[model samples]
Target: MKWAIAMVDGILNVLKPSGMTSHDVIGYLRRVLQTKKIGHSGTLDPDAAGVLPVFIGAATRLLEYSGEETKSYRVELRFGVKTDTADDSGNVIETSVVFRPEQEKLVAVLKKFTGPMMQIPPMYSAVRHEGKKLYQLARAGITIERESRPITIYKLDLVYQADDYLVLDIECSKGTFIRTLCEDIAESLGMCGTVSFLLRTRSGKFVLNDAKTLEEISKAPFDHILPIEGAVEHFPELMLTDKQALRISQGVVTSISGVAEGKYRLKTASGLFIGIGSANNGMVKADKVINPFTQM
Candidate 1:
């Protein structure tokens, strides 16, 4: 039986579908789970689809620590057009003037993007300026000056190339604009383009293959909320005695000197996930103690 309450709170791996905004999933989960403490790791465009990690209850707080986690994507580019939206959902503003490249040239182009580079965020993005979304101004047919940010592209492989469409798998940092990437790739081949399709294959270490979609969630609500410790598995693990756990749970910081300095998991003798905490000067401390959830 599904419990009305969680035993512990962390993150939920959601396979977001096209046509629904990140806010839509959060809103739905908030009501379904009946909790105000909910948040998501990243936003997938309304036209794009794939992995969106939703943090629930105490897990929402984990974002502060997991902000630097990298992501991966699979994108399809149609190399004969351009759009204001930088995606296929926008108006076709321009057509190609250059001939399509051979498969070998496309592979070489993909290789160029597999490292650090600069990317300008799309106008149809949630980036805010003067207290308004950039997309708001874009919808009004207005253009604004946006700066290009540095991003790391760990991997870029050409999955396939169709008649006019190119498919690729890329591992990049957060905040990377895939639209800009496809456009740049097109430019490298002496053409104009936009993203025809995009699906996030991975986020940090979470893969879409391991995710549960909103449609599945709606049909069969799940109470399998992972513990907060699960979210910070990438961090170092630290064991604390029951006495130390109690002290930390009551908002007390216990000092365990002669250890490495960094964030670590605070677990009890019985292996109960207390929460996440940082350590320095050999003294470990709890920054946020994930309270044990009650059974309903």
Candidate 2:
């Protein structure tokens, strides 16, 4: 059977429901859009739900840059329990008496996590170890030593608290594990804990409120797709001349001035996106040129 070709190239902010792995979402999109060139910017746990940016066609090329963007989450931590995976989905490893710390004590503990710190990745994670996924080894009951990675917590605020449950709003850098953070917080308070619920509120510029569900995406029009330019709108723009545009398309480095020494979104005089490039010392090097023709 002949498969339908997808000529569209853009990004889709999807609201992934619980019980679906990040790869599962991709598989579902492949069937719905009839395209294989699809990828997500970041991975969300199969048990967690929220904003997952889906890139289609040429937008897949933007994944590397987009993954560097910060993420925000609303997480619920349940005290008096600890799981092997640091989340409710894992096997119970330990338990303790439910103790709700005072608000001042909770605030003090959260302050220590703010800013940069070292974090050891959980065993049941996608991180690769010895040429195999950590989760793969975790399933076999094999545990290996893991090096701690540096991560930053830009903001950590207590949103709500009850007898055994505490909700927190966290804005952190990429690669952060909310489950691990919750476990650490509990440990600091002399108790055991795990992430009970997680919801990604924002990833880079994409907000959860603007995310489309699988049902909505199944019936979405082409207009629902965001252009590749939208993915890198935060970068400075560099307008190119016809001759320069041609050189960029051919992977030729053209001299440029007036722009700062940094990455920029190369575009034509008419606002047509060319690609991304870097400008420094009156020279602009072609990074990735999308359009060849000067006119649209």
Candidate 3:
């Protein structure tokens, strides 16, 4: 038997389809599952697709601890055109002579963007200014100065190139905007550019290969709700005795030895996931405790 969405507590690796906004996915899940506690670790644009990690019920509280600070994408950039929103979905604001950079030039430009760099979030983004989202201001024809923020590009590989389009595989730290990267890269080669297609390949340990589509999940929702522990697999682990587990559950810090100082995935001696714990100065304290009986 399938459990109701209200009773389900875990993470879901959803293969988000293009044309649906991140909010749309959550709204659809809410209607299908008949619950409102669902939330996602990150949001994807309406026209971009790929892995979107969703947390249900108590799992929503574990989002910050998910350790999903890195994101990977496969994006296609089209040169000689610029859009108001920096993507094909927006109005074309400028069109210039078509100019495709040579492979050597493109490779060198990609290298220049690798490592640490500054990126200004697009006007169509959700970055906040003066208590309003940038996109909201953009919709009202209001433009504001945006400060460039530091971002890291771990890798930028040119996958494919044609007459006027090029595909790139990017692995970057959180908060990177592919549209801005496309524009910046093209500008370096003396051309205007915009993103034509984008697909998120990975988010933390969640990958596209393991993600379930909306239809697949709708058919067997419970089968797609993964365990909460899987979301925090990147953190170290600590085993607790029954007594220690009980104490930790009550928000009591327990004294321990031989544990390093840092956050960890707390588990019972019998291998049941408890929650997240912080270890320091020979004491282990619960940061977020999962209700053992409530987990799926």
Candidate 4:
């Protein structure tokens, strides 16, 4: 499919696979889409699978890689044991004090995690310590004392439950680890547990339903990518005329008339997304520019 020149520049969202790192997904996209300018907004553990937002072309410029946004996951918890990694891949370290509880009891126990709390990042994680990876230390049979950071767990819903297992749909701020949450739940229940499965159900507005698998993406004839402008559709906009679109694309802050006192999503007369802009007193400036259109 032929695309407009502005649209040909990078920005894409790829659904990552379980065995691949975020960087791996970019590499695959680079080969499939034939562009070296690919990047991702977040990191997904190699064992975890689900929606991973990928950026292509100019969209790679937008990656901040900061854990500032809320993240969501659908995960499965295996009760009756805890692992060194707190997931199925690690060595068993502790066993449950009691076998799995009844369904109602499991739901009740999970409710406590639905608010703000301190989370001590796992030793087998990507977190750095003394210029080294935590996982490196963990693999070396070394454990160091670490500080717990505050994180918010907005929602933790029980999707399904077995006699000794629970499947959860979680919405939390960035940096939350499903395995850790499972471990915390087991501790709260006076038992031990680990995560057998984890999948990111969402990343910002990117959802699993809209995600494409590697196999699917690899075979697809054309790049089914959402334009860079499509990534930040949540932001507000201010519509501009042809002249204004040109000026904004050139990095010239143009006066957007008739806008007052708030942030808006910016778009051109031809419906090309310009960027997010804020206005006060009929004057507007970009809050963040995602895509600049070709106009003269």
Best by TM-score: 2
Q: 1 or 3, which is superior by TM-score? A: 3
TM-score of each: 0.87, 0.95, 0.93, 0.82
- 185, model 4: CA deviation in Å? 0.8
Candidate 2 stretches with Cα past 4 Å from truth are: 221-223
Write the residue-wise lDDT of candidate 1 on 1-296 in tens digits.
23345434667788888888899888888767767778887788998889888887678777877656788899998888999888988999899765668878877888888899888888999989899899999999888999989998898888887777788888888788888888998989889989988999888767889888776776755554555665677787788777777877776767876768888878876788878877888766788777642221
Q: Candidate 4's residue-wise lDDT over 1-296, tens digit each? A: 43333335644456777777777787776667766666787788887898888776677655653235678998988878888988888889878556767667767877878899999999989889999989999999999998998888999998887777788899998888778888989888778888888898888878788888778777872566776665655555567888877776677766766667876668887787776666778767665676767746
TM-score computed on alpha carbons, candidate 1: 0.87
| Predicted candidate 3 versus true structure: per-residue lDDT over 82-193, tens digit per residue | 9999999999999878766887887899999999988989899989998999999999999999999989999999999888989999999888998999899988888889
Give the clashing pairs for model 1.
257-282
Candidate 2 lDDT tens digits, 1-296: 35566789999999999999999999999988888888998899999999999998888877777877889999999999999888888899999988889878888999998999999999999999979999999999999999999999999999999989899999999999999999999998879999999999999999999999999989873656888887777688888888888787777878876778998888888777888888879788877766564442
**What local lDDT score does residue 126 receive in model 2, on the 0 to 100 scale?**
95
Which scores better on TM-score, 1 or 2?
A: 2
Candidate RMSDs in Å, in order, are 3.8, 1.6, 3.0, 4.1
The models' CA-based lDDT, in order, is 0.80, 0.88, 0.89, 0.76
User: lDDT (0-100) at residue 106 of candidate 1?
Assistant: 75
RMSD of 2: 1.6
What would you estimate as the lDDT of candidate 3?
0.89
Ranking by TM-score: 2, 3, 1, 4
